[model samples]
Target: MSSSKTIVLRSSDGETFVVDEVVAVESQTIKHMIEDGCADTSIPLPNVTSKILSKVIEYCKKHVETPNSDERSLKRILNPLILTL
Candidate 1:
């Protein structure tokens, strides 16, 4: 069987998005599901929008695919530090 898992999320506009479990786990709500054994089925995210949801997924995918290990990743992850200075 495939070790990969999928999650279903519902947008505020009534759209459903099927995303990878890893990506979905980026959210605390979904993370809790995995930890509590409630991730076997589609997760209902009634507060999110499709546009914002897509952006979040994109960020998670980028982080998973090419995790910043050196300066670049560090900078991207902590860019706010520069502005705070």
Candidate 2:
């Protein structure tokens, strides 16, 4: 695969994070934003707190890095509420 692009995400509390496109797209919400061209700048996650968003980003990065991991295991890492958009 070629080098993955990066995406910037802004949390509700104004915290910003730069993550790989592949990792960002792990969230259906972010995937749609990219598909709709709304990610040209930073994607704002107004409903998610910085703390929760950080956890979500970490989870996504791990998921993208480990393609062989089981779905059940992924679901166990964080609260289900945080996983949903």
Total colliding residue pairs, candidate 1:
0
Provide the lDDT at 46 for model 1: 74
For model 1, which pairs clash? none
In TM-score terms, candidate 2 sits at 0.80
Per-residue alpha-carbon lDDT of model 2 for 1-85, expressed as tens digits? 2336899999999999988888899999999999999997899999998888888888887777777877687667555646564
Candidate 1: Cα lDDT at 7: 82
lDDT of 2 at 73: 73
Count clashing residue pairs in model 2.
0
Q: Per-residue lDDT for 76 in model 1?
A: 80
28-69: candidate 1 lDDT, tens digit per residue: 777897788765666666787777677666666666666646
Best prediction by TM-score: 2
List candidate 1 segments past 4 Å from native: 1-3, 69-85
Among these predicted structures, which one has the highest lDDT?
Answer: 2
